[model samples]
Target: MLRCSHVLCKVDDIAAVVRDYRDLGFTVEWGSAPGRAHNALLWFGSGPFIEFFELPPVFGLLRHPFGLVHGGPAGERLARWARPGEGWRDLALETDDTDLARARSALRTAGLPVSRVIRGRRTRPDGARVRYQYLASRPAGLPFVVSAYDPPQRPARVVHANGARAVARVRMGVAPADRARYAALVGEDRWLSAVPAATTGVLDVELEGLSGPLDPRKLHGALLAAAREERG
Candidate 1:
């Protein structure tokens, strides 16, 4: 089954952003740490999760080619100007691939671009050895990242806060050109109207009645508080 796994958020402050999700009542799950080289997942009940992937300290938002490719920063022009949170970063889908072959074919048949599969074993702080398969690529500059759950690695189900449910409609604000390409590539007609709003340079994830609109400012405050509580 195809499910929206996580919404990737490229942020300047990982802790702060993470806390925000927790404050909003979502159960926050931290991934392999060391901050810079890792990411965190905020479970939104069942399958849908929101992840915060940090940019290496040595590099700014736009410094990496991958970031730039997905509407992030590029070169040394200072990506901070592009704003802290923006763009329809990436969409991750979950698949159970025992052989890891059939999962690849589905993406090909759908004409979605595919990237090399990365294999690695991650040790959780609790001493759980989790193995994962990461497949990602930009289909026409629109990212389609797929991940298969390896049972022996970690539990397939993630538990978030109670009453945390993903509403049917989630608005992804994007540039007209990019938005059109995304709709065509994903093969979904989620875009309500063809009319594009002014360029905020930041991708806004609009939740129907959850919390109106989400941005870095509100997120930062909430995440910081959660981290402090978690640390204490």
Candidate 2:
């Protein structure tokens, strides 16, 4: 089954962004390879976390033979989208199934774009190894699929001062006209949902915290809006 794994936030400065989140009582860790886009990860217990990264300035200008640039097409697109300011950019879904062929077949049957599963790996500063398979979406705004071969263990740093526990749900804002298209893209998933609103991107995310519900936006404006919406 598809589960909302995390959300990607593109920013202009990693250090500043990390500080902003840290001030909000959330543990942030720097985790980016040299020569690539700078990034930091925020762990939200056992549920979805947030990934913040900054695209290289020259990303859009460079073009590759495969129609990609410095950080590939996704990076280029994110660079453009974040030009206005930092906010929600990408959503990720997780599944236990590691069979790419079967996953592709299922997505294709649902009439969704299915790219060849690509393998990815990264090593943590403490010598932990991480590996996963990624499947890019067609429209680019929808959540991408990530199947982890060796999912990282929930660290002791999962606790937060803000009383936040886990990501409850994600709501995507879309134009009324494109509702059907976006709905089909998301399918009928419980952890993920969409609604017609003034915007056409990630609307808000809900978090289960000790103080009931918390919206990340209240803590940081640049941090995309995240709030709990009744799932009925």
Candidate 3:
């Protein structure tokens, strides 16, 4: 079964985004190195971290190549439809294996839009390398599938100043015709709750914590809230 991996937010400034999120009690990590720095990861240490990134000024000059890959090209499809200031672009559902063919087959049989597999890899800040692959469709705002080629290097748990634990709710605004497809993508993970919309995209994300809602404007249009009780 596939589970929500992580969500992407297109932003213009990594520094500002980090500052804003930290001010809001989150432990935001800059996921890129200097000079070519273009992203930050909102790591909750568990399920679904949030990735806030921006395309290069000269992104048009980049190329998308075939076969196993490293860096920029692989992420080209992710940023293709996103604008710098737009929040909550695509939601990725994940599998434990690197080959997404099985997942793609299921999606297709279920009548969901599934693209050919694309693989990628990158080194983490600690120098650990990670490999992954995913399936995506060209639809403007639909969820996608991703899988790790090897064991994931991300932390299994973390302490958030805000007392966050998990993603409690993802309120999605989806197209009526694609409702079933979206439903078939996830299992009993009730994180996603959908409402019909003129278009398909994330409407809000409710994190499992004890804080109030955030200002969507600061979040580039993603309406996020922390709404879970702290356990003793």
Candidate topping TM-score: 3
Estimate, for each residue in 58-151, the C-alpha lDDT of model 3 and write its tens digit: 5633434421242332344544534445677778778887788888788778776555777767666666676888777545376777896465
Cα lDDT tens digits, model 2, 169-188, are 77777777556656766667
CA shift at 87, candidate 3, in angstroms? 1.0
Segments in model 3 whose C-alpha atoms lie over 4 Å from true places: 56-80, 212-218, 228-232
Stretches of model 2 off by over 4 angstroms after superposition: 32-37, 62-84, 210-232
In order, what is each prediction's RMSD in angstroms? 8.1, 4.4, 4.4
Query: What would the TM-scores of all predictions be?
Result: 0.59, 0.76, 0.80
Q: Pick the candidate with the highest lDDT.
A: 3
Predicted structure 2, TM vs. truth: 0.76
Worst 10 residues of 1 by lDDT: 221-230
Question: All candidates' lDDT scores?
Answer: 0.47, 0.64, 0.69
Q: Model 1, 188: alpha-carbon shift in Å?
A: 5.0
Each candidate structure's count of clashing pairs: 9, 3, 0
